[model samples]
Target: MKLDKVSAGYHKKIVVRDVNFEVSPGEIIGIIGPNGGGKSTLLKSINGSLSLIGGSIFLDDLDVSGASAKEIAGCMSVVTTERVKPILMTCRDVVSAGRIPFTNGFGTLKEEDNARIDRAMELMKIKELSDIPYADVSDGQKQRTLIARAIAQDPKYLVMDEPTSYMDIRHRFELMELLKRLAKEGMTIVASLHELELALSYCDRLLLVYGDGHVQLKTPDEVLSEDLLKELFDLSGDMYRKVLRSVRGEKEEGSTSFFVNRACKSFPCHDVPESEFNCMFCYCPLYDTEDCGGDYFYNDRNIKNCKNCGFPHFRDNYPKVIKKLKEKMYGSGSQE
Candidate 1:
């Protein structure tokens, strides 16, 4: 998919500009930004749900800008955060809507439609909800149902806004993993995501839209670089240092399996519910540690048993770590 100079927002003024980017076939590109940063707007523009004032979107060789809604749906499917045209519908009916592109305006499903719907439900792991009333299900289930509907469309291109909106960490990771597997199986996907760490760790590429109208398109590795993240986020000094440290945690030596609980003011892994531990938590030193075992994490100062922690090691030389981090930030600068 190709996005060229795509600019869009309410009232026709561009909230973001000069957004030239491409999504390679069978690759996942994550669109991320601060709230009101035009992340969702960009996705809508590509899916043709929102008209763009200045640009063209192409899926393969087809120009999405000039295509009808049905034509666009023929090549692309979308799962939006907003509940559009939702009065009442069963999960079965919802999933079947994905087959609309091939059906008449009223959508008469064929036998293959039933099979595709089943496959979509199995993929989304929501087959049990097929007979359930979508309106009565929880948001997480509804989100999955809508996604299954999108999957049933079987379009080469899939677009979603905050696919993880109502899911837990495990479910979120599962959804992301599904996208990755689907990409490997030859589907091109672009989704707006709020979970920066997950997107950076999972997506083939990351597209950051800065509030100032500048855009950053880079691989996850390039986006992780100090200069890139600092510029993309307009972060500096302490905040920059903190975020870098968090990002840096991905490179650490411990298991990233951890969680941050609100009350203990600490993240204890031992108590994480099975439903909760769906692998959403990062086990790196950024969040917590797993070496000591049982709910003890790196955050909330759960380093009570780790000897390497800055205790006597940093009793007098504490500034060394921060200083070295700063030097690393400059690429070639030395503390001396």
Candidate 2:
């Protein structure tokens, strides 16, 4: 798939302009940017869902703008964030809809089509939910079902927007791994991801879209080495370093266990010495504990108020905060 000088938006208004990129076969390309930065608009243009305001998109020499619906559906599959409310449909019924483009006029499913549907359900780990009502499942299950539906289409190119949105950590990892396996098997994937860590780890290349209609396609290493994230996201010093460390899989080396975001408007949220204040626990970790060992109280609405608490903000209390969190997550006996 290739985009040449493409510009797209809603109804004659251009959101992203002068975009030029090409996605090769068996590659995983990730689109990432701040919210409302035209990532979704670009995706729609690529999949021929939204019309291009300027330039052309091509799928192996065939212009997407002029391609028929069936022609486009045969080559590409899409999974958007839009929720589909299919009344009286089971999860398997929803997945079966993917075969429409390949089926006869009455949409009869053959044995081969049924086999592909079963394989898709298995890949997405949604076979257990196949007999359940589509509306009765949780959001994560619904997202998985939709993914399975897209997989059943058996298109060469897969396009997804925030595919991991409603999934938990384990499912998110599983989905990324599945995408990698698909890419190895010669499927091309283009996805917009809100999770920077996953994009950095899994994507073959990153497309950074700026709010000012500027776009850059680069490797994850180039993005990190050039410090583009700091400029793109306007991250604070501490947060930027933390992200860098996380991408590199490096641990904090020194005795510096605390961070202070002095640039914050709410600097000194608690009255403490500037030199000793620790902003590590900006929101207290012990807020959920009934006996929180901090100066807190319940409001008239039974809300736990920590307006005057400074226990977690002191530099020396870092170990205590970690211990408390461990005890809360595990049993007290598990705390070292």
Q: Mind giving the per-residue lDDT tens digits that candidate 1 earns over 1-336?
A: 888887877687888888898788999998877778888888888899888889888988888878889789888999998975456778888898888778867778889988999999999999999877788888888888899999999989999998889997778878988999999999998998887777887799988888776677888888776357676666777887786666556433212333234354333432334434322332223122233233433434554323343312221333453354444557445434
- Superposition error at 194 for model 2 (Å): 0.8
Give per-residue CA lDDT, model 2, range 1-336, as digits (tens).
Answer: 898999989999889899898889999999998888899999999889899999999998789999988899998999998999999999999899888899999999999899999999999999999999999999999999999999999989999999999999789889999999999999999999988888888999999988877889999889988999987777899999987877665222223577778897666555568877777666567665464655665666554546545354568887887887777678699455
Question: Which 10 residues in a row give candidate 1 its minimum summed lDDT?
Answer: 309-318
TM-score of each: 0.73, 0.74
lDDT of each: 0.75, 0.86
Per TM-score, the best of the predicted structures is 2
Model 2 TM-score is: 0.74
Off-target runs (Cα >4 Å) in candidate 1 are 248-336
Instruction: Provide the RMSD of all predictions against the true structure, rounded to 1 decimal.
Output: 11.6, 13.6
